[model samples]
Target: MAEQTQVHREQAGINAAAVRSAETAESTQQRLPRCRKLLFQFEVDMYAKIKTERLSFIRHNQTRLRADDYIYLHDAVADDRNANRLGNMVILPSSFTSCPRYMHERTQDAMTYVRHYCRPDLFITFTCNSKWDEISNELLPGQQSYDRHDVVARVFHLKLKQLMDYITTGAIFGAVRCHIYTIEWQKRGLPNAHILTWLWFHVPSTGSMWPAKQWFTLHERRFPIHARHPTVQHLSVHLENGQRVYFTEANLQQQLQEPRDTTLTAFFKLCTLDDFARTLLYCQLPAYYTFDASTKCWKRRVQGSSVPDHPGIYQTDALARVYTVHPNNRECFFLRIILHHVVGPVSFHHLRTVEGHVCATFHETCRRLGLLKDDAQWREALEEAATVRSPA
Candidate 1:
């Protein structure tokens, strides 16, 4: 290309020195005509000049240009996390792409895929095999597979493309709804593709060992979740005050409010008139009844919801789970304990009741039940430390 360009430059009666070769551009050293290397520099210079001209125009026409804050990391970063106070933070903008920030951005973006398609069903790896006939056949007599990096790269690229086609076209994993893949170079300079395929929720006729429906069935049989209903959904516990509200932000345009009725409140209302409900524990609610989210209530299910053979029995395949509470939250931890032993609590205060006495606090209620261990050892250790050791 340089020889052809030089031919045209000569025809146009342009000076040989005009489009400078490496010899003219740098007096230090020039082994060969560096037009190929100089071509890269020419592009870089042209881009910078264009940017400089635009900035000059924008500055002159400040009134015409729409104003906004501009933060550019052209040469380097301008911000650091209190580097002077702690220590030096030498990381620059160029390094940021491979830094933790870049990794974090990619990981968060990966979650959006998981959320949309549910979790991935298959994890696949396509590593470049050095022994492939395509790469091995093209090698010279004495040369190894790694001798020609170009050949290895080209062959791997083509193979990866074909593999991707098979997955995306629903040929490999039957009816693959979607797939996510990433390519990485190993230490041997060979590329490999990591793939995650979200399979369609149908069992195919052939060439499929792990379709979504079959996978779920196998797992559910091995690890049943209490009892399986026809379907399960988010249920509101209205009697637990403000339990349904998620405080995601400190301020809102309008105050958030939940509906007045929920499963817990509905149960209390039901127990007032039904002796059966009063006898049932909170955890057993779903096994006996189905939640009506639209009405914010629980209704008796038709017979055979669980026990299909019996027509007179009231049983269901579903069971409502009283979720375990983290011990860090004292009140909730205490409440969960009482819910396990108590049946059909009408109110939060009722859960705190021990035997016949209405306790003032949930903590005191658990203590009365002998659920909380005494902290005499810890208390004595701290008291001794206070007298013996300095505050620091």
Candidate 2:
């Protein structure tokens, strides 16, 4: 009886080795090619769309900037109000630089608020770090350094769209209001922004001022915009000869009317969902592509077809191979569902090369729900069972 038990243990070790070897082989076969393919395709597509849309807009024959255009631009400014004073103002952390694409939108928002609320004074403040003094000295004469002037300008331009949308919509819930602030703090390795707002609302004669804690809690729940990451970059246009080039909106428009670049057009075509998916498939499968519990259905992406409702085994091992490469690849899964129809038009939404760490965590979470089998070894058995028939 002891000899038989030893024999069983030896057999189990052999089976484990074989399973590990098979998993490794399968993983290697699916990973490398998928990563290279997906990333290359996405970059090509994104470049094309930007070039086409941006360049084309520059060419249109609109000579006169209208009142509506100014209103659109004004909406980008932040809002500040004091109790009973009913003034609207915009503020930013004093390190912003530039954004050309959204100038009009910012102008519109600011103008709209001023017109409606009777031109509230703009209060610009700076959140200066200790390093500002050292950086200011190094700046060329007449150059704007990391001071309040530069920061406010950049913040106003960078977040024009969001600022305008909030104020015009009349969604003001809290007493004090804040707007966008763009800051650069890379020198200290903590570069980013924090939007600070102060709210003041009317109080009747009998009512007392609300406590700071209550005010902050309400502010957090209602006006929750704060500093985070920088979303856009400001680039300068230069001539092929390495000289700085300046062109007015009229000049850019004139150039656009003449001819369009074919290369730009082709680039956008490549960034579509199909191209992105194809690239991702070359790298890896999703780590955990299972049915969402809240949604109560398994998600699948098919070319040119809407995702179908069905029960399917979670392909965890297959997904793990791809996710081992890039963690951001998981976002592709969510994008695949939302942009199913426009996969070919969108460039950045593919999940084929995500890193396995995040994928594994997601897979384990799904496992708890019984969507995935506990052991990969059971895959073959599951496949075999699918083909077997029970005697009637």
Candidate 3:
């Protein structure tokens, strides 16, 4: 009996320690300020130049420019030689000066083949974040001498491809229809890829399909759903006038006032596993909220229509089964939030229409600036990268 009592005490101590650690982490995260949003200057001129140059190249080939061809074809980025912060000319590579028409033509062919075979839905972009300390530490490893651009480009390429492989084949989301990736160098000479991937599937569209019924196969085992049933997953819990309150699916809509197009409802409906792990994610930071007596939850300022049932579908995510409904195509609330958080404001223009033309324009800019390597070098790199790849 003494031994059992000691084991119980140890377990209780571990649980208490874990709770304290989680609270500390949450408090720290809440204290951290969100990075300010910024826009890249290329948004103004790079895309226009690509469209003009791409048209001339295509017209001469006697081939029609299908909406999808933009994914593979393009021109070099145009930079204002006089607009530098330090007033010094940006020294770019010699090859970066001209757009390679032949290379883009070949890429167009590859994209055509992919479009015919794969019916992709979600279009995604993957760019390397220079601010990531972990990558900098690994690539720069103490006392290593290397061309900053070359090393950074190589590492980002390999890492991005690794992530792409995982996403396409992973159970979370199946095979992508096709993916077009091109590397570009920023004014500061940092290399990043403008990648466009069309996944094979996506979340159900909004409107008539709005509020998609939670998909699940009923089993012999029982599952928790409501708050009073103490064993289900919850977003929050607190004491309300001395009565213990839990935020479960039953009260989520009433207590949280979640917008119609938000993912909260769908997520909670599908959150069936009582023992499933939970994570807390704050919406916006540098902003604080106080619990409302009427709503019984934290009140914070948010963008998007609060009217519920805002018309028009703007975005979709298959893995999460979430949709953002907005009347305007470019004003997708959820996607904007994602771009702000994941890609940073510098690359905000990369987010665009589902057809992915603007992204291709960025690739064209890379080619014009000679940021993209010539066919021979690119082919050699692909051969080397493929040598160790496991066959499908």
Candidate 4:
């Protein structure tokens, strides 16, 4: 009996030791860092390549213009420049402008008059979808489901940081003052963004510079229609007080109002996870122009066009063009943002139009100025211009 009791005790001790070892192993597995797992699951090298491609697109297009031009247009104005130009440049408002007191009063009166004659029905609906489920099957098999929105938001964050870094590094240097607001929106099934921006600059006084006629004259131009309007016109005027004020109008109503708290607003402020996702999209997925080997030139790829019911990317008739990357496939990430449709006070006479006329003119001008050699590509670029579409 003594021997039997001793044997039983030994067996219990072994069992306990085995249980403790198993528990320790389980805990270690649970507590392991996820970095290695994620690295193994997703092709980190491929992701890095994607990031490189995105950055390359920005560098390619942005570098085509003089750095001074970008800095002058996109940065803050120096005080000296402001003083010399007599403050003929002012910041423009964004898309979220509301009615002023006078306009509000007029609107109220008009509503009261119309309300008595007609009744309108109003309705609102809310919809939601899981980002993971929407994109899971699109990912490689055995790959973990990551949120597409989140990935885009992360990309934007990185891009913003890079832009800031570039500015600080003196890669972009100028005297103009500017502010940018990135807004994101995902309501119902639609998800997109708006970048509310303000810029203040000064033009050197040549005595012939007239604020009212030469400066304040806003021209009808085409701009990107990210949200509502397809085109916009922007202008600025010098006031008697030596301050320049800018404005934008569409259909007799101002579209550039004060910035509002849209999804993009929240994202820039880091107020919500949704914003982070948007930031990612902005940084990672900015549209760019890519060289089409088959076409033997650059072309624009629409984002997310592979999705059902998506309208393919359209070419414009305007001089300046904004290109975007097609969101559906990774191969066509470098898309162009044709600036032709953009509405602003500045004349796009220098920009090449798709109709090939402006480009031909530019090439001739460059030749006259001894700036460019007569190359075959110039003719090719001109031949491609006839395809741009003007806004109706």
Candidate 5:
């Protein structure tokens, strides 16, 4: 019986080694080639498109910028309701780089129409991480395994488009009023999407007073936007090279147990949900309460440190840190749905006070319409176009 057991153990070890070897071989053979092939195809497509579109002297006599024209431009601006907003507004320009080229125009049109119909509070961007190689060897059915990068990119784009359409069209964020989006291809030949949304509700501003239903509370354990270390609990805030960085050091347990330790605990709870407090505390790291060895009590450092000056009157401590439903801080129960959950590589998300992205889109649109050569011509064209109803 002892001899049989020893033989079985040796056999199991051999099988494990064989499996590891096979996995290593597969990783080297499959992953590297797929990435390389995708990259190569992207480079070729980008070069081809640039040569055909950017440098093409083919005069598109069309006086107005079409939805399809904005599909590939780095910056695309639209006049009318789809125009980006100014002030403390939230704009989500989400891009999916996996949709088909032919579908871009129709998708853009449908999104604009829906945005006009629904009228939501703000826009949020959506991106999906690709898993083409995991799903199948060939990019498409009937193509050679190694030679399907183009088809794979196209199919992936289409899949993302379908997903976004279902979600934005009254699935997740409720009714959207007006929105605009763009689809662009990457250096790797994969398609990416940029979607803008405006909902029926107005996202509450930090300084202004609004109805109670416009805001909600956020807990630290539920939404952890703070920087915390477990092994070394003692935290100090200081500025270095114009950036907020965290440092940990060994300290006596007695000092940590004092009231000073509670500052971080309490501040983080407020910081996560308080946009106004967050802005004040952003780059300016305030000093925390520290135990003076002689005094034997907590004493806050007096380096001109002050409490956050919020604009509106807070009813309670909980109400002071109330936050509106923004994409980056969006949470459902104990789970963070957007920031912590969504998987995508190329994306941008933040709260904006100005429409900084609008100029680039406007200029690109003008250039494409051949109105960029002369300022007089461009101004005249825009003035003439303003008289007519804006494009759908």
Candidate 6:
């Protein structure tokens, strides 16, 4: 159901992008070379026809609904009060992604949040500028942002998650009590987010305190927006044409001295010894323990952190985060799901071993534990039925 919701969200975005009027497309300079403007226009036209056909098909074939003579009914008769009436209509429910009902429910949810937390302190508008270096870097030859909106959309989604993580984790404007956002496409065909954030403490003006430029700028004092443990130097390097370079500790021992007493190793060791450590999931370690590279061990955190909503109680969240796993990868995906419950397994074989019986694969193990709540009963029934049936 969660996966279906995700799929619905993605399709909603794609459909919205697809059916948007080509007339609303931003005009580039008359002199500038056109890439796939005609292709985009064609896609728009096709999407419109597809949508109309789909609605018509649904109207005919789908369950027509009406209230007495208007909703959830297969057929309806004209009422005495009102003579003018059509057949029972196929209504778009709240589950229809960005339909009127869905949008209304979403708005109501935001209103409920506002009522709970009061008016938002920060009103941030995050624009997905196609000019971002990340987007430019990924574009193939002869391709523009408009040409590959999937890529643009994905990059925006990832960056939006990062931005939200920063805000919610109190990296900016302290902690946020609650946040609600809506994404809309501008007249320029660029997507932008209108975010309303309610901070924990009252602020006179957030803009004056933390300027937009500072949020974007990669200052020396701020944490670098680079990947952690990134390679200091590339293997294929041109020898200096009188270009002076110093040999540092990183140059000598970067590859060599990857210490054995890292977080994972220490976690495994601690799991064997410490009862408290054994209770923790893999990602929950950061809530109680901090990794010390110099000391080469996991140190217990004396002071725990709190979130905006749960200020009184210590939370395992925010201290660590795991990357989202796409459900398509069968073995890897199932293994990741299982690891949420079974943690600090010393080896891969140990991970596979559940309840003293080592399963052949993660899927079998998941079935054994009833993990992911898959249709195991139906699967088993099919296997049993296949044996009983004779070959045709």
Best by TM-score: 6
Instruction: Write model 5 residue lDDT over 1-392, tens digit each, in one string.
Output: 36445545555555454334323134376442345556566546644554344222122211111212111111222222222221122111122123253244334333333322433344444443345443254344444433544445445455544545544453455444444555555675445665655555543334323223321111111111111100111222211111111111222222223323222233344345545434333112222233344543334334333455633422111101111122232121111111122122011122110133422232343344343456754353354334222433
Per-residue lDDT over 253-315 for candidate 6, one digit per residue giving the tens place of the 0 to 100 score: 221233234344556667777666676787666665666657757666556565355334344
Worst 10 residues of 1 by lDDT: 216-225
Local accuracy by lDDT, each model: 0.52, 0.30, 0.33, 0.29, 0.33, 0.52
Residue-by-residue lDDT tens digits, candidate 2, 1-392: 36445545555555454334323134476332234435335434644554444333333312222112122222222233222221122222122223342443333333322322333322333333434433444333444443223232333333332443333233343333333333444553333443433234432333232222211110111121223111111111111122221223334333223222121112223334233333332212232232233543223323222323432322232211111112244333222222222222222212211323233333333343343455542453353333232110
Steric overlap count per candidate: 0, 53, 9, 60, 30, 9
lDDT of 2: 0.30
Ranking by TM-score: 6, 1, 3, 5, 4, 2
Task: Go through the candidates in order and give the C-alpha RMSD of each one to the true structure.
Answer: 20.0, 32.0, 31.3, 29.4, 28.6, 24.0
Models sorted by lDDT, best on top: 6, 1, 5, 3, 2, 4
Candidate 4 local Cα displacement, residue 327, angstroms:
48
Candidate 4: lDDT over CA atoms? 0.29
Model 3 worst lDDT window (10 residues)? 224-233
> Of the candidates numbered 1 and 6, which has the greater TM-score value?
6
lDDT string for model 1 (75-129, tens) is 1113532211322223322223344755543443344345445577878888999
Task: Write model 3 residue lDDT over 1-392, tens digit each, in one string.
Answer: 36445545555565455334323134565221121111122222433444444443334322211111111111100232211121112222222323454343334333332323433344455566665443455332232212233235545555554555555544235545455555555676565555445655653333442123322221112111110100111122111111121232233233224322112322222222211111222222112222244544333324322323423211111111112223243223333233222211122243332234554333343333343456643453354334323121
Error of 5 at 295 (Å): 88
Across 1-392, the per-residue lDDT of candidate 4 in tens digits comes to: 36445545555565455334323134565321234345434444444444454444334433222212212322223323421222123222132133154333323322321222222121112122234233443334344433233333333333333433333232233222222222334653233433222113333333321123211111212122222111111111111121222221121112112222222122223323222223232222122222233433333444323423434533321111222223342222211111212212122242334334554443343344443454543443443332222110
What is candidate 3's TM-score against the reference? Answer: 0.24
lDDT of 3: 0.33
Report RMSD for candidate 5.
Answer: 28.6
